[model samples]
Target: MVEKESSRHPEVALSLPFTGLWLARNSPARRVPSHGTDLFGERYAIDFVGVDERRRTAGHRDWRTFLATEPADRFFAYGRPILAPADGTVVEVHDGEIDHAGRRSQLALVPYMLGQAARVRQGVRAVAGNYLVIALPGGAFVALVHLRAGSVRVSPGEVVTAGQHVAACGNSGNSTQPHLHMQVMETRDFSVARGVPMAFRHFRERPRGARQFHTREYGVPAEGAVVEPLPLPGAHSTS
Candidate 1:
């Protein structure tokens, strides 16, 4: 895919929403309209799949991995805490969706992909699942979607600080597996919002297959790279 030209909107700086290693996917640093479409303010959206020290997405792979759906709890990302990426006021929250089983098999994925259009047409609840929208100081809205059912802790209008735990990752909505899907947009209503470029602050990234990690002071992670937040002096990393 061709890289999109730079956006006219100023980039928003954010903190990585979770601790522990994660695999970056559909990164805006790789291309604009990062998810391959501009719908639902996803142009700059990115996905992070939780991984272990060995970079495995799950502890075990069995017949289900190749032929059917797996339990959502089997994935490393499932139930992992999802945090606030910046200090902001919660503008919206949705927690009514049920967490679904995860799919890895091509057979399973094919049918799911075919239903993409229907999901989109069903509106935000179908697409985003359990989610939260934070209104940042400068008119930017940060959204974190596909969260675990019943895990949301904050409500609309509550103030949250960066790194505050707000929910957990889950296989919900249009997700094929448990992961975090995040994006910054121009407005709280994603239906009419425009995606805004965003960068994470103070994270360390290791390219796939490499043992060493490099620190990024302020930047978007490269697609396919494994990343974790840089350790803070008094903060302990959680799984």
Candidate 2:
């Protein structure tokens, strides 16, 4: 276990969870509202898909198809680093959920979609695959969900910082495909943790239909959009 506490380094900005190339932004392909419960009405502020060289998405419609059919291994995020988004301690860690096979066929997804409530009843054990909860120094808690099984590198009580390599993203939990689901909460108990809107600092932002990336100090990438993680100065988006 890396015991070196990292809260002191305010200068280093950690890499986004997946390293290579981002395929989507914070939300799904359709720009849908992103709360665990549609009835809850909480909105996701940042994007989940990281845009990099391998991206081929032109819009939400294209991404929806790609997510359903792509082979799990070809859509590999197997070794991708699950970085710490803030300086914090590992207050909780849950692992051992197996990654499910990707369901790209809308027909296949339809059955599961109809059974969504049943899946939820299966509870945290069924979904949320491997996960970790971190308590940030300022009292905020961040949840990293759908983590790759057996890839968690930290344990409870361990201290981590923004951008530290913690785990790898995987096709676990309620995910029909491999992707990372992240959110901030005021508390560590996720069942009751209300999702809080969060933002990336000094990152690049590209509005839909724009040809270029703009440097942003604090920005929220939309659901299903693809964005690349850049260094301090950020970079031109390939969208």
Q: Name the lDDT of candidate 1.
A: 0.91
* Clashing pairs counted in every model: 0, 16
The parts of candidate 2 lying over 4 Å away from their true place are 1-15, 23-33, 36-47, 50-54, 57-71, 233-239
Relative to the true structure, candidate 2 reaches a TM of 0.75
Q: Write the per-residue lDDT of candidate 2 for residues 1-239, one digit (tens) a residue.
A: 11113222122223354445454444522433455352211234233543344353212334536445444544545446778776789999998988776666686688778877886787765657788988876566778888888989899999886667888877887777667777666677766655554556655555566667666665556544456556644332210
TM-score of 1: 0.94
**lDDT of candidate 1 over 88-181, digit per residue (tens):** 9999999989998999999889999999999999999999999999999978899999999999999999999888999999878989999999
